[model samples]
Target: MKKAAIFDMDGTLVANSPVHIRAFEIFCARYGVTDWREKLANGFGMGNDDIMRLVMPEEVIREKGLAALADEKEAIYREIYAPDIRPVEGLKELLERLRAAGIPCAVGSSGCKANVDFVLDSCAIRPYFDAAISGDMVSRCKPDPEIYLTAAAALGVSPADCVIFEDARAGFEAARRAGAGRIVALTTTLPREELEREPQADRIIDSFADIDDIGALLA
Candidate 1:
């Protein structure tokens, strides 16, 4: 199997889950949805479309449409997060090492194309990835293997050869379903205990810096 790396953008690429939650709060306030927290009780790893449908009332969705709400909320998130955009610890070095080793990489994010571009461009890491699969491009997002599968296909790599990186339970499940060779989840969004409660990730780390040997993980 050819070796490759696949990454999830939101919490995995940058510790931006807090920023997303804040953006959702702002959007919910604007829409008079005070119960946003409860609405998102399921999980935070889902795509914007799934999030809006889960958090917004039926009437709100009917009035503004799911696409419009997703766009607006993401715009707000970008405005709030762009000023402090940076890659997670050890990201640059990891990418460089992977490149030097000739292992192709791809971004498989459950975020919209705009958000994906925003993060990649803002962090100046767009050139590191050979391919990217965004939420808007897929009919189904995380918890389904479409995004990861598509990214692997774009890179001409087999899922069994890809080391999928993620930060959420849903993302882990998605990676597993995609048949990634290994699933390395970061505890950036959730604690180790919580992540370890389930067997989604083959290994869980606090950050990219925690990995002393990336090659070993893939093997």
Candidate 2:
């Protein structure tokens, strides 16, 4: 059977984690929160609401509300990163090979739908994904496996026949828990050595271009 390749959007595909960090910093500044740098350092792959809750005290979290800040943060992120939004090196070539091989592809991410749309549209990779499962689509985000499971189901493929490409520890764990056919951990946000510590990936690569034969990952 043809296997499916599930991709993570942010650092893995579009290299926008830094943009997100900057946005969070600027957004929090307006609220008189000055520790956004520390928050982002450890919260790169988590959902927006989760990050907000972590950075803000419980009372503050309840008062400020994530939806309001999320909109402003997203706008700041888009304008700041718009000039340089592009796919990771070798990602386009890998996508082309997958298309030629008829391997199904999907994007499963802890990013909101608006963020997903902005990144995919900016990168010009929207058409390549069979489905884009964002955090907004599910009740639980990464480490829950629901997003990856959703992608697998959308592709009409069994979870055991889908290989996930991820860049974060939580996402790697999610792919493992999702029962994917394989997990290829890409270390764009984290160092390759750090990503290797997950014990969930079948292989660790710096980028898709690092793989000699990307199709062999499904084998």
Candidate 3:
């Protein structure tokens, strides 16, 4: 009964929404776009390409190119967020414990490979994960269940045997649609009150420390 633990990178593993929002604001300012913050908020939990399509003009995308624009914005985000890169409270200990228990873990993120690598490497948690599935690896992003499903498959585990740890509404919904065994909502991005309202969340925790028994959760 191969069980796996899957995690979302940005808000779930690292607290970087503020930095991401700031980067978007900088990118929009440089590109003469307005209301960037609102666009970022509206497009939260989505891939950079998807978010850019909502905020950037067709001419701008054509001029800078979608890939280039995404790269630039993510570069800005990485620069601003690099110094503050650290795991969520108890994340390292939790990962170690999970590994010790022989629970294979994977990261399934809407972030690009660059951003995901930066976070994992900078936080020193990359070695804990057996596999990583980024936005670039999936044709469909969260709320579509493709990323989560891909992670489960990459870990050689069934969707029904995987537990997804997520911080956003879209991620929770994705886990549910993926038929994950359990959807654990992390309050790193959203308030507990808000996360509790998500029907897909089988368990809501503030941090990994709150979970005393990883084996129990997997069981």
**Superior candidate under TM-score, 1 versus 3:** 1
lDDT of 2 by residue, 1-219 (tens): 438888988888976677787777787778888866776676666777877776765676677678776667788888898888888888988888888889889999998998889888888888888999999899988878899999999999988998888888778878888998888877778887787677888888887789777547768
- Maximum-lDDT candidate: 1
After superposition on all C-alphas, the RMSD of every candidate to the true structure, in Å, is 1.1, 1.5, 1.4
Which candidate number maximizes TM-score? 1
Q: Please provide, for model 1 over 1-219, each residue's C-alpha lDDT reduced to its tens digit, 9 standing for 90 to 100.
A: 449999999888999988988988999999889888877756677888898888999999999999999999999999999889899998988998889888999999989999889989999999999998998899999989999999999999899999999998789889999999889889888888998886878888888888888668667
Residue 99, candidate 2: Cα error in Å is 0.7
What number of clashing residue pairs does each candidate have, in the order they appear? 0, 0, 0
Rank order by lDDT, top first?
A: 1, 3, 2
Number of the candidate with higher lDDT, 1 or 3: 1
lDDT of each: 0.89, 0.82, 0.87
lDDT of 2 at 75: 86
Candidate 1 weakest ten by summed lDDT: 37-46
What is the Cα root-mean-square deviation between model 2 and the actual structure?
Answer: 1.5
The TM-score of candidate 1 is: 0.97
